[model samples]
Target: MDLQKPAVEPQQPEGCLVVAIRMPVRIVVLVLVVPVRMVWDGLVVVGRFLGDAVLRPLGRALLWLGRVLLVWPLVGLWRYVVVPVGWVLGRLGWVLVVVPVVFLHRYLLAPAGRALVWLARGVGAGLAWAYARVLTPVGHAVLWLVRYLVVVPACWVYEWILAPVGRALAWGARGVGRLLGLLVSGVGVAVYWITRVLLVLPALALWRWVLVPVGRVLAVVAREVGDALGHAWRIAGHLSRAVGRFLATLFRWIFVEPVRWVYRTVLAPLAHVVRDVVLRPAAEAARAVGRTARQALAAARETVRQTRADVRRALFGEPRERDAVPRREPRPLGARTLDSSTTALTKLTKD
Candidate 1:
């Protein structure tokens, strides 16, 4: 029975076929077919949803990108070729305009400016030449007078007189120095001779015989005298200090206090009264006199000013001005001294 049991074919669901099928085999077929159909349907639904949800939008995006790519070539052509040509043409236009302007500036304006500069330079040179022609001689005369009459004379006095005096003084100083040297040498030699012959020999002999006993007696006497002198010196110092202090105190009491009292009592009042009555009145009177003098001076100045205006009108035929000629007075006999002195100074300077 087990060997006779065999596998059975699976049955189709809706096909028109008459076949004997086993129950287990049928159940197996149903299970396999249901799952395969479910998987296929699910794949078809997913494909359709993917087409609607993703592929449509992606296609539209690709179409839009294609249009943009198609437009870019025209824009690139316009930018690279048309705009560059237009820009070049605009720059050429500007260059053409500027070239004419540059030529005009160089050929026309530059020469005009140079001509104006030359004219100004010629005028300035002419003015400078005239100024030099007018002023140079006067300047030379002034310079000549100053150098010859003033500076050269002063330099001559300093160099000739003072230099000789200084040289004589130096020579006299050298002579005096030589005499001093000789005198010092003679005195030094005399002192050396006296020390060697008289002082050294006599002092040595005296030291050998009598100096020891005399020195002892003299030492005792000198010690006593020194003690007495020291005491006397200290007493004198104290007495002198006391006398100075007493004198200071006496002076303060007698002179300073009395003077201060007298100044405060008698002189101060007199000084105040003099200041208030006499000095103040005198100062006020002096101020009034000064004011009156100032007013008179002002009136005199106005009169003189008017007189000068009349004089200028009469003499120079113009009003007084800064550039007017200075007045010269007639010289008396004594005034010739100036010319004489100038001539002497000029001669001295030349010498």
Candidate 2:
């Protein structure tokens, strides 16, 4: 995409200063950049782990909680309560306001508008009739009189006297214009050639012979400098990455392996022993005690209930029974929805 760059980048010509400066500068930059890059990598790992394990799920749960606590309730309020209320209000407004407005428009305003339209039509028609009867004939007479008194005489004078003079003047002006145009065109051609020889050719020669080659050389130098900087930065990145890998390996050997060994060989067995021997027996004893306590409390509750019943019986003897009441049925045994004698009688012995 970069027109200055070839499809395959060739090795650039390095000057003495570039060769002298490259090694020391890279070494210094590497020393300065290594610690920063390692710290940046560590932060990146920690950030990714935290985002994956903690922040992502926390954010999703918070989003769901917000929808439950805030969004759903508001949506329900708008859907169920607000929508119904608005619909009812709209109906009420139509009944109370719009109905009357429509009735007034149809019954009162419509007739008034029609009356005004009819009156306007009548006035327009009267005006049209008056214009046709009075103004048209008067305008025709005035036009005829003006044509005889002024227009006819003016036209005759223009045709007979002024026409000949205008033709002679036009012929004279045409000859003068043609002579001047020829002189001006000759002068323009001479001026154009003189300026071209004096200015344009010299400028063109300077651009073609002098500036182009120098510009091309400068462009090549600038492009080479850019490529050199890019190449140096890429090499430095590779060196920095190698240094980071070495540091990681050293840290693993010096600290991580030793800690992992200690955890596996020492703490793991001790934790298992504590779980199997001491903590498990203590938990079982606690659970047994809780079961015994619950049983005792339940038995005490039963004894108290029996004692309370005996005391109530000693005080109140027995309750009385209620007297029986008769049931009230709605209809007689033979009654129905369609009663007899409601329909027409049939023959007594029909087969």
TM-score of each: 0.25, 0.62
- The CA lDDT at 175 in model 2 is 100
What clash pairs does model 2 have? none
Best by TM-score: 2
Q: Which ten residues in a row have the lowest lDDT in candidate 1?
A: 14-23
How much is 87 displaced in model 1, in angstroms?
86
How many clashing residue pairs, candidate 1?
Answer: 0
- lDDT string, candidate 2, 1-351, tens digits: 122334686767867755665666556655665565556656777899999999999999999999999999999999999999999999999999999999999999999999999999999999999999999999999999999999999999999999999999999999999999999999999999999999999999998998997786666556655655555455545665677699889999999999999999999998999999999999999999999999999999999999998998889966678898877876666654343443444223221
lDDT of 1 by residue, 35-78 (tens): 44445545776799899999999999998898688767778889
Native-vs-model 2 lDDT? 0.82
Q: All candidates' lDDT scores? A: 0.77, 0.82
